[model samples]
Target: MTGQSLLLIDGFNLLSRAHFATSYNRTDDQLKNSKGMYTNALRVFYQKIFNLIRDHRITHLSVVWDVKRDETARRKKYPFYKATRFELPEPLIHQYETCKAASDAIGIHQISLSPYEADDLMGALSKKWSGGDCYIYSNDHDLFQLLSETTSQIIAGKQGEYVYSLSHFQADYGIAPEQWVDVKALLGDSSDNIPGCPGIGEKSALPLIQHYGSLERIYENIEQLEPGLSRLKKKLIQGKETALLSRELSQITCDIAELDPLLMDDLKVSIRKDVLGEWLEQMELKIRIDSYGA
Candidate 1:
């Protein structure tokens, strides 16, 4: 907590937010550049990144991206994981490429690994940078499991940005941050297609986790559950396998071997002024370089 602060960005998370924010009601043609490509996401993405850097006084930065869904280990374990998501729009895909190029041009370190999601990379990096303060920028509730004394999550909401700390999580959930995976394991995540215990929702899941501490322990002491929870115990018994599988899918991988060699010094933010200016001109964005302290 005393060392330099690191900002870990959930790359596609921010891009999708920016894209939807600017293109909600507008047509593709309305946000295109002179070269006939969409600039809406790119402009907003750049602006948001710089704003966060300044707002947080971030000394280190890393934007993490997910590998293809089919290629990820989670999808391999559960083929239906995130299967309901639609393909990205053509305009948004173009902007994603442009944003990556711009990130490289500006010297923002970008990290990605095949067969691993961005969440895993962020978790690994947060663990690796444990000596420093790490702020994970994402709205994904799945990342809640990564919260700790030194690591926090930054959720960008409509009204403003809010930091979710470990204490805030403990107060809200009435359990340790690591226990969040068990909560998800009991209730499941519809967005990710993780099927938790059947017939159990947040109402049943929260209290069970708060009392039992974890999915494993809940099963270990299933027979000891109060008579008032007979129906809950039945559901847990029926969905034991599903709940265990869901926990595996819900938990973030924190000890990725590939990320072991990366050092904090590698993530030090050093924007390339000339490259950024040229890239912005090519993209026809009107953002002033001087505003970023170039």
Candidate 2:
């Protein structure tokens, strides 16, 4: 444990949430000054996360991103995964690029790999981030598995009251934080279109897994489960390969090479006023300068 902490953002998850909330229609250079969806999103995200850093006494932080063009081939493994989501709007897209540049200019780190999702990157970094117990910044339940006695999760929210806690994750999910990924695989994730065991859900999977100990154990004695759940167990057997594969897919990488914290030692506590100003200018935001309290 490094004693120092890091705030890891699932970058696109936050970006997408901000983009739709404002019904934003972004354009290149439209957000050049940070008025664009991405800029505004980044500002709120940065401020909110930084505030948490201040609140929690965190000494280091970074945002993890999914740089792959199409979910890093997740679609290949689970073709319908995220197939229903809308395409990212142009302004929001541009802002993502600008946001990275802005965050970088301000000296914080932004980690991404082409074949991975932010969750994967976050997981990888969490395991190997060299910092003390890591705190992941998302409610992506998929991440719940990373929780521990000291590690935790923070649910980002628009109203500033996001849910957070490894303890909550464990209590709510009925297993230790380390078991969440496998638990999710057993239940399947609707948001990502993952095909978990058809009838198994958080309720059944958590307890069943808690009692049975492992998917293999559950499968080995499928006949002994409740009759209603027996049908679900069959489905689990049918999708056994997927149930297992999704677990693999959902497991965070914990080995990403780019998340080295020492690489972030140069980051300081102050926002770069010039970078913030330029970003705002690009967005055509007519902030009264003083409003920034600069």
Candidate 3:
């Protein structure tokens, strides 16, 4: 087992959290530089990244960002997916490029696939580099599916950070982590606007998927199940199509070929005091400039 762990961060998730945490609205929360460029998002983002590296003793880091939502394959397959999400703040949108640049300058590996969501990239990368022991940082429950012997997830909870390892995932769900996609397919994800099987939820779905292994298997042995779950069987039969489609939507694509190994090698975090201080000064964050350290 490698002592080194690669940290994969969900860039948009953290960016939005930082953006909202700092300011309530676009008008009043804007932290501008002398040239009036919005710097609040990047400032908070850098500090968070710095803390993660310092606290975790992480050396390899990758920041995976979501491309435009409309450009994603999921949106094309399901038009109503994520339709309930509010529009991103314009100020936050404006600062995205700068934030990416700041991260790049900080020497962290940054990845963004034009039409794929960051979750997919993270999943693919995690699987690709599992031998190195990968830890993904995201609050999105959908990512729980990616947990494995060599991969885990760190979630920010109200109390503190929660680390979900493969064993922990199995114990919590009573099934392997990979089965999470099937569970979500049956229960649906309200946040992503995925309409799963009607009336099926964690209570009902977890056990069903755990028993059958997958949606296909469940349907194949439908006759065997109706005797035990007569009422739920009816709902399952009724929502079979929805369940199948939801599975496709809930599953993160791991076939993505986004990260080049050589490029990923270049992403090792190395703090350059001069560049770090320059960026902080530019953002008018002089007070926090010294935190990155030499």
Estimated TM-score per prediction? 0.96, 0.79, 0.91
Error of 3 at 6 (Å): 0.5
Number of backbone-clashing residue pairs for each candidate, in the order shown? 0, 15, 0
lDDT value, residue 23 of candidate 1: 92
Candidate with more favorable, higher TM-score: 1 or 3: 1
Top-down TM-score ranking: 1, 3, 2
Q: In candidate 3, residue 235 scores what lDDT?
A: 89
Report the C-alpha displacement of residue 41, candidate 1, in angstroms.
0.7
Compared with the true structure, model 2 gives a TM-score of 0.79
Model 3 quality (TM-score): 0.91
In order, candidate lDDTs are 0.87, 0.66, 0.80
lDDT of 3 by residue, 128-229 (tens): 774376889889999998988878888888998877898998888888878889999999988889999999877789888778898898999887785556
By descending lDDT, how would the candidates be arranged?
1, 3, 2
Q: What is the C-alpha RMSD of each candidate to the true structure, in Å?
A: 1.6, 4.3, 2.3
lDDT of 2 by residue, 148-170 (tens): 65567777666765646776765
Best by lDDT: 1
Q: After superposition, how far is residue 103 of candidate 1 from its true place, in Å?
A: 1.3
Candidate 3 residue 148 C-alpha distance from true site, Å: 1.1
